[model samples]
Target: MAATEITLEVARYRPGVDSEPVLQSYQVPLREHWAILDGLTYVKDHLDGTLSFRWSCRMGICGSCGMTVNGEPQLSCATFLTDYAPGPIRVEPLHNFPVVRDLVVDIDDFMTKLPKVKPWVIREVQSPIEEGEYLQTPEEMDECQQFSMCINCMLCYSACPVYSLEPDFLGPAAIALAQRYNLDSRDEGADERRDVLSSPEGIWACTFVGECSAVCPKGVDPAGAIQRYKLTAATQSIKELLMPRSLIPRSKG
Candidate 1:
């Protein structure tokens, strides 16, 4: 019997040397347990020293090794090579962002947008140390638990068609994280975040193509979060029209 072998068609781009990305192929031993990340490691260790990509934890938690596998955004650590066996597998950097190098897309866009959403519990005033920690019911925790699983892999951003078409869009992951903090029982910063999420470049820019949810390795449904926020925003608008300004809690910057 012969050992199984697989070919990887990896995209390569060197800043000044290459005009555009080109596919570079490498053959590696195929073990049923080996993932696409492992294949890349094999290439880096034994074959090519100059090849570049990002990875950490290799267990799918760090989310640093996201790339396009067969044209779909995936955490290479979680994607098994056996799934695309018997031939060459195509791997490339994530889409909708500037490529920094071979198989590494720049995440500066996400870093800029993520902070605007303030993906943490915000308070009008900090509790005194003697007051102890803020508490929440299980139900309150459950509300944002799923969205909190985001690993910031940028896979959702790469999968988002709206982000691809409109670079200014607030995007799925950031909006989802915003909702996560806003829904927290201890958070009082929803009003502070309202302007950002309600802006033209925010949730409204999302056309609900839902690809962001499809490629999420953590099962975080960013599309659903955006849709839910839309409903909340619309209802608030209706109330503002029918009621007095003093009766409603106006969102503050």
Candidate 2:
């Protein structure tokens, strides 16, 4: 017969109470359809009322249920408890981030760095309202569509070794989102983003570990985006060396 229950070793941290995070174990029914998030919910409702975590849409689209499950970054809402059957499963806040309460982590660093990349369509001059929206061909859309799939889930950042060591790094999600806009045919802010993208703490800091891509639940390859941006930055540097800035054509808006 299959196991009837599973033990979850969840990390708990409460400010002014616990000196450090402690693992608290709880047993919940093992159902085939139940996910790790469901197990956590069970603990909160039935086992421990003070258990805390962040989750919105149970669907993977929200990307808010990201956490470390058994030493790997995963979306607790999508990772079923049945996968790790017959034993204890560990759940903790995402790596490389400060734990807020229990499974909740402080993402203020990422929030501040995201805007620095200016991940939005920018135009020096905007057309009047009567002009309608800017249009793009399917081919043009394909250039940045992969990067646009990122839901700002910091899983990539948590899996990235570089971000763990260097907190100043702009991080995979921010860089990938930056490429989403930089590659957009209607965007003209490539030059404006050049300073941040090419800085020492930006793409240069990424060692291309590829963990950022491996752990991306959305199938987005942040490692590839960073590499592509590096090439673009290098080409721009060569052009500047060969010709004057005034002669170099500005990126199309």
Candidate 3:
């Protein structure tokens, strides 16, 4: 029997150390069911200790293993080596973010944007805690269920061209999170968020390339959500002109 040899091309760079980021190659033996994270670990343990990357859950929950594998944002733990096995695999830091180290990126920008969107429920009506859990029928929950699956892996952010071209575009992940709360039946703050998201820094910046939906690991259609938000905002503008707030227009209401 012979060992299965795999070649990995990893992106490397260090501030004030390396002139520019370069791809460094490593060769290793792999098992049948080896994840991409295992390959990285093997290289770190035997080949190079200086290689920098991030990973927490060996499974796929934490989303810490997110990186661009051959130009696609993916979880190293979830992406199997055999799935892309021929000879060489290219691994690099996630895109649409500033690089902090080799495979590490500064997530402060992402965190700041996420919080700006208010990714939690904002209910105008506060019910008693003793009344039991916030009640939502299956249909109501379904409206925002897909948005809830976002693991914040930020693959959608990396895949978005709007983020790369215009860094202030509010991006996909934040927009999706905002939609998550807005679509909630218990939330009455959609109107409040519309002002912010309608700004130049928000959903209006998206050019509708639709790549965000394609790269999402959790099946969150961020592009669709943003488009729906745009539609809703447009509808509200027209309704406001034709009908006053005091008068009850059933469609606007």
Candidate 4:
């Protein structure tokens, strides 16, 4: 039998009021088209205005509404309640990060780490203003197109056991974003990003658990990116070691 209404077991927490997060249930009308985010909106609008969560662009582009649904990380705006059917649904803040309140996890950690990987194009020299834009071949665009889809949803981080265990880990999304720029023919920043990404807590920290790729709604395979970085870093190290001592560049004191 199809359920007319579904119960949402939403996690609730307030800094001074609650010592720990608690699940609060609310029966919401089960519309086939309604997503879990809609149910949360209904709760905020009618049942409890105090209920807190994060959401934007209800279309899943913003990636702000990421949360643990039935123990799996997902964007609430894109997850249909009808899929679960006939009963209650569990919703909690994303794992592997500190919760800000209720469904909002503190993303400051990721924000801080993102810049360290330098997820942007770099050029050794500045082009003149009249020179127009840097061009890339079709193949070049294709090289980074898949990785460019990441929305910073952090679902990958939540699903990553390595990141959960080691907070310093550069993590899947950051490394993949770095690769996104690194693969760009217009970007000459691979060497700049390599130092941070090749460090102990970067790509090497990933054990290729692949859960990061599995949980990504955008289809960005962060695991593959990490593996690629490992190979590239290893090959560069070998070349440097093999090069004659006289040919190696040295910095002046």
Best by TM-score: 2
- Candidate 1 weakest lDDT stretch, 10 residues: 244-253
RMSD of candidates 1 onward, in order: 1.9, 1.3, 2.1, 3.3
TM-score of each: 0.96, 0.97, 0.93, 0.95
lDDT string, candidate 4, 1-253, tens digits: 6669999999998989889999999999999999999999999999999988999899989989999999999999999999998769999999998988988889998999999988887888989979999998998799999999999999999999999899999999999999999888888778778789999999888899999999999999999999988998887777789996467443110
Local distance difference test scores for all models: 0.91, 0.93, 0.85, 0.91
State residue 54's C-alpha deviation in candidate 4, in Å. 0.5
Model 3 TM-score relative to the real fold: 0.93
Please report the candidate that would top lDDT against the real structure: 2
lDDT of 2 at 137: 99
Q: Per-residue CA lDDT of candidate 1, range 142-174, in tens?
A: 988898999999899998888998999999999
The candidate 3 region of ten consecutive residues with least summed lDDT is 244-253
Candidate 2 lDDT score at position 57: 94
How many steric clashes between backbone atoms does each model show?
0, 0, 0, 0
Candidate 3 lDDT (Cα, 0 to 1): 0.85
Off by over 4 Å in 4: 244-253
Sequence-dependent TM-score of model 1: 0.96
> Can you rank all candidates by lDDT, best first?
2, 1, 4, 3
lDDT of 4: 0.91
Q: What lDDT tens digits, residue by residue, belong to model 3 across residues 1-253?
A: 5448888999998978987679999987767788889999999999999999999988888978889999899988988888777758999999988888999988888888888877887777888889978889999899899988998888888898889988778888888888998888878777667777888889889888999999888899999988988887778778788889667332210
- Per-residue lDDT for 1-253 in model 2, tens only? 8889999999999988998899999999999999999999999999999999999999898888899999999999999999999869999999999999999999999999999999999988998879999999999999889999998889999999999999999999999999999889999999899899999999999999999999999989999999999988888789999999999887532
